[model samples]
Target: MIKIYHNPRCSKSRQGLSILEASGKEFEIIKYLEKELTSKELLSIISKLGIKPMDLIRKNEAIWKSEYKGKTLSDQEIIEAMLKHPKLIERPIVINEDKATIGRPPENILNII
Candidate 1:
């Protein structure tokens, strides 16, 4: 099944949802802000995305700039930061099977799904 870590308040996330709806494939929506991911879950997602922890961060978010920017953090530290400030996570992460993509362009989801 396809699963999307979504933030409805985000326009990009809404666009990603529109793309998923157009695809006609069933998907699960996780309101990540309301239901934050655990460190283990975030680590698994990073692994599936084939990227480092920083790659999944929404660096422009104030939470990051104010609290985490220019900090030398371990992988675990980054994951913990995201859990504490879920908005620091990049929006619209879609996962299908073992593959995952951060839906920045929204179209990125098409490649995985």
Candidate 2:
């Protein structure tokens, strides 16, 4: 099964969802905002994405700029921040088995699913 950490308000996330719908494959949508992920859960996602914690962060988000920018945070700290502020997480993260991708272009999700 495929799981999409989706934010409906985000256009990119919506596009990714549209793509998944068009694909006709069953998938799960995790509206991460309403149901925030725990640190361990996020860590698992980051691992599956094959990226550093910061790579999954939306550095431009207000939460990041006001509180986390210019701070030399450890990987754990960044992941924790995202867990605390799901909006600080990038949009449309798709996971399939052990593989995952941050679907920036939305099309990137195709690679895994």
Full-model lDDT for every candidate: 0.91, 0.91
What TM-score does candidate 1 reach?
0.96
Tens digits of per-residue lDDT for model 2, 4-111: 999999999999999999999999999999997987788899899889998888888988999999999999888788888899999899999999998999999999
lDDT per residue for candidate 1 within 1-113, as digits (tens), equals 99999999999999999999999999999998888788788888889999988888989988899999999999889888888998988989999999999899999989987
lDDT for model 1, on a 0 to 1 scale? 0.91
How much does each candidate deviate from the true structure in C-alpha RMSD? 0.8, 0.7
Clashing pairs in 2: none
